[model samples]
Target: MTLADTLKGMIGLDPTAHADADMKAVLAALKELNPKPIEECSVAEAREQPTPADAVRKLMTQAGHAARLPLEVEAVQSEDTVIPGAAGSNPARIYRPAGDGPFPLILYFHGGGWVIADLDVYDATPRSIAAQSNAIVVSAHYRQAPEHKLPAAHEDAFAAWRWIVESAASLGGDPSRIAVMGESAGANLAINVAIHARDSGLRAPLHQALIYPVASNNIVSISYEENRSAKPLNKKMMLWFVQNVINDEGDLKSPLIDVVSADLSNLPPTVVVTAGIDPLRSDGEKLAEKLRDAGVAVEHRNYQGATHEFFGMAPVVQAARDAQTFVSLAQRQAFGGVPLEEAP
Candidate 1:
């Protein structure tokens, strides 16, 4: 079978399967594809079976193997930089493209609901975007929810963008060519950051790329109801994340919590991607309509036969790569030409 077919088979397993057996099969798949075996696997095997989260992480690691990512790209050097925010510190990795004077910049947030994923976890996707898009990538490591709470992640995200704008010249990125991009909850953060930027009268992002973002405050979208138990990301996990992020139900209606409810006028050009079987699909589609109605240039596409988190699982499927390519191209066009001192 093709790699995609194999991936479909593996991820298609019942989510309610025995955790141990499921993890074993997932580990075996990773072993087949050659993974950086974690020592915890042996430790966990000797103890009580892995949790569902553990199983999902293992599956995601295997999906990394299934991605069509160009494994060998000229490495863009990165350094950890701390950016000041409203709440506290937001750490970011500054990716400088090769031969760059001042490349266009992309501020990336990772998807892990609002809690789980981190900058290192989503490293490959950003690297691919940097290499293919030929732009500097600043991956934001925002504070997770439950620990940071609602508006904390959002505050840090906006602060990271502000810091990028303030320090762009020093970091070899065009301040005028700043774009915001994220996946899943990160995508949610990205859209909300644009909302903040627009409302605050600060210069908005030149472009925004949200890959199947969580855009609704309400959890009644068709995809949410249909794919509630889908693998990689599920309804319970999503609600859990959302609950942890927001303090009260009242916060849910706040424009900060739901960009779909916010005024989308005067926003930047947007490329919104939605997955066929993702619960968050309708939110993105709705957000796309709002942006267009507000006169923002928008290109929205839904990838059929894919699930949530497909954008970051580049190792498993071509759909992920294709989406990245599309987003990168859109960013390039939206930013026009990078007026850097050197070529990126």
Candidate 2:
């Protein structure tokens, strides 16, 4: 048998017993690709690693299905702009649903462990959010690590958030109804943005939706140990990302990075989404609880059979679809719209 077949057999008679069927299938496909561990690969090589969305797209195409493209919402138009930043300017993409008046705004951050992925790699997420929530989604393309390093991306994220808040009205967005949303590293930035807003005496985001955020600097947590070998985002990859992003281990203690230990009070209402098989699952769970303890209105959901990056694979992963729906409903309610049913 081939190596993948051998590995699949080793998992158990039914590999899907512990994971969603689609998640298992995607992991199998990823194994077939045999990507090198991020720690052992150059940044360029690591960038080639198959994302969950990539795995799903490949599987669909191999099965004679059309490739799933970013959803196009009717009346929604996207535009590219350069926002003034600490460093000259930052590139951003804005998605606005078709409407005459201002709409709720979401300042979105894309995840790549703060290193590799770019705005294009995460286009589907903001597009989906904009379409589903009928809101404006402004996705920032922040400077990456090993090139710009920590505090750089954080500065960019906050600057973008500040700029959007000030320019919301000009862009057809309602500043009063703005929110922050992101996945993984982006989620970290989203939370930080909310924290910064609150501390700076700026109007905080109405809500924050974090999908499997990297909340803690500690990598030895229970979920980290349990999902050390998880596909898409293994512990080693997480470490590699940390190494590239931070100047030294001392930087880990910074509140901007170690969000779990940061002051969480006075932040906006929050929704924390975690995947069962993701190494960062515990981080999200713990952050939600801490937020609640700090008197922040919080909602937490953990999808039992999903993996890291599953939130962006909605075209094939049912859990992703459900998670997106959950986020959209949360955004709608936060924006003063009718709420849909909560996620199952």
- Candidate 2 residue lDDT tens string, 1-344: 86555544444233234888877877777767777777898998888876666667677877643446444554568888888776979889999876666899999999998998887788778888998888999999888898989899989998998898999999888878999999999999999999999889888899999999999987877677667777777788899999999998899999888898999999988999999887899899999998999999888999989888888777777898899988889889899897645423
After superposing candidate 2, which stretches have Cα over 4 Å from the reference? 1-17, 64-75, 340-344
Q: Candidate 1: lDDT of 300?
A: 92
Evaluated against the true structure, the overall lDDT of model 1 is: 0.72
Candidate 1 lDDT, 230-328, residue by residue in tens: 645566667767777788889889877677788888888899999776778888999999889999989998876666666654544567667877787
CA lDDT scores, all candidates in order? 0.72, 0.85
Q: Report the number of clashing residue pairs per model.
A: 9, 1
Candidate 2, TM-score vs. the true structure?
0.90
Query: In terms of TM-score, how similar is model 1 to the real structure?
Result: 0.79
Cα lDDT for residue 295, candidate 1: 95
